[model samples]
Target: MIKKPLFPYNPKYPSVADLKRRAKWRIPKFAFDYLQGGCNEELNLERNESDFDNIYLKPHYLKTGGEIDMSVELFGRTYSAPFGISPIGLQGLMWPNAPEILAKAAAKHDIPYTLSTVSTSSIERIAEVSDGKAWFQLYHPTEDRLRDDILNRLKSVSCPVLVVLIDVPSFGLRYREIKSGLSMPPKMNIENIFQAMICPEWGIKTLQHGIPSFATLKPYMEKGLDLSQLGQFMNKTFTGKVNMEKVKAIRDLWPGPLVLKGVASEEDMEGAISLGVDGVIISNHGGRQIDAGESSLISLIKLANNPKYTGKVKIMMDGGIRSGVDLGRAHAVGSEFNFMGRPFMYGVGALGDEGADHTINMFKAQLYQVMQQLTLEKVSDFPTRLIR
Candidate 1:
């Protein structure tokens, strides 16, 4: 008989890497690469996690340890922790109805779960699962009509926060994806067949459900690549319309806290501040869009320390965090909150609905261990315990 996971859940769960391995073994090569692979050569991708490993820690064992308060307050709302599930498009491709699983898991834990503009599930579906704590990530469709409709859809779901992804003003050129035949909802061709055949578990689940599609996009377009082509057409069809004015218009409509993701430049940061946004997530789209840009960690450190950024707005970071040490290093340097795109998705891919819960437990476990050694308590203490 299969064992039951701990009741009310337990933080001392499996490792995120374990989930990654399980996900890899469960999905086709195309799907696995979509979760794991990054841009050309993936040097930046490897560097993102390895950079965290390079940072050292100094323990203070003699200090009287206290309670670990993981709760955080950001943009006038309190969260259970400083980390959240970052958005990924078409999550159902990894697991059947993945967005719902992520949203439900995040809600059960009282954390934020961001919904991608391209998610397989609708915003309203997330609202039902996440109880309106869901955050919406906007990609800024090129057409005003389409964009407004999307925003209205998010509002209908009663989402509390809006995170606009600006890093992908245009999609990045990812060589690994190209080599892997990575497509949204994926293309089930002769090549993908061999890939599925290799992963019997993934293939069986996929066959049972008839393969994941861009369910949200299906109503707008026909089946298979035809629908995908329509989405691509819409993207190219409206690229020129997504500008500062477009962003401002969105700001005017959405009355909740607005944060901008993919912010990499001082001017962009300044622009977000000018727009009167609530916060900014310093990210390089998880090193997904650009090849030469600095990691969000370096960018966050610079932006947070800058006199201009002092209390002007909240500063957060993504793109390199893998463990509590990484999250601690980022907080020590300057970042306040963080988001992880692939890791959480990997959880869902690895174990279907249970993936997000397992991944969150694993990360919490890693963080707890880090705290045990550092003689620290509470996530807030991370900023003060910095060491070279």
Candidate 2:
């Protein structure tokens, strides 16, 4: 007999916007700003979402279809959905134990969970929670020894994929973060303290979990370093710029699937291919890197349509993707897989532990609904439904 499926999502928070609203109220202002704010005027950030509105999908009312299949395969493994949680740094500041909570949810949902090198949760801890299914995103360290050590640790935990970030040559100047004193290692002034007081839930959870730190980098960091010292260490340790030499060096070192995040042009894609990288994530650091950068959608459209770059390497995208319809649009365009950072964090911030599962379920349900409406049975058919 066919068994019935369980509905796990909260109907009240059916959309990412709903989660965002609830999350904003539950977390401190500084935390909310860090999660939501983009760099400079945030024009690129606004465009990232608005650009999706231009993409139209055609539905076939008379087409025959059975059950909708949302399953997707990437890097030799199948996932419940095409999208996964993108890596985010300082996740605990958004909500206590945010990385662990999302990692558990991703594993439960059979979706990929990427852990940032600078996140609050340690690599081993996340790997343990995700049962070693989690992916690791590395920010190339200034020291080769440090890089090798981190890679070895990830290998020890049996990480399946290694994502190298290439966007932050120099960190973007986010006005909100600067204004709120939410820099690296973060400053806890009187205003920040008051903001924390207003969000009692976040405060209590933070107290329980303790202050968020750079968990992955803890081994390299000196003990008892203050915020100022930590900032100095961070600056001294991570060089933002990534050249072809750096990519090639990492390519030589890492044996697993090597993916380059922050690819926005065919030139960058070509560079990734030339260096023997396995995949490229077409992102603009969620519009936190360049204020004038093209949206990831535009880049996907350009590269996916180009025969030169289409089949050479795996192409994925992440930036301003907030809904199931957006996912469908992305697939219709060119993204083989998709990822979102703030959405999952927003999920954790909204409902704490339950938020991750709820958010994943919501995306699955919405994507399924869109597929059903279009009379498309498989995710691969989404391209055909694109109204060009």
Worst 10 residues of 1 by lDDT: 5-14
- Which ranges of candidate 1 are over 4 A from the true structure? 1-13, 183-186, 207-210, 222-228, 237-242
Tens-digit lDDT track of model 1 for 1-388: 9776422223333556666777777777777777677776666676677767655667888999987777789877788778899988767776667788889999988778998877777777788889888998887766677677777877777778999878766676787667666643235678878887887766666676665554544455545556467557656643552457877998998888889887878999999999998899988877777667777777787798799888888888888787766877777777788888788877787777677787777777667778778877877677667765
Model 2 lDDT per residue over 24-43, tens place:
99999998999998999999
RMSD (Å) per prediction: 3.3, 1.6
| TM-scores, all models, native as reference | 0.90, 0.98
Task: Quote the lDDT for 187 in model 2.
Answer: 89
**Model 2 spans > 4 angstroms off:** 1-7
**Model 2 global lDDT (CA atoms, 0 to 1):** 0.92
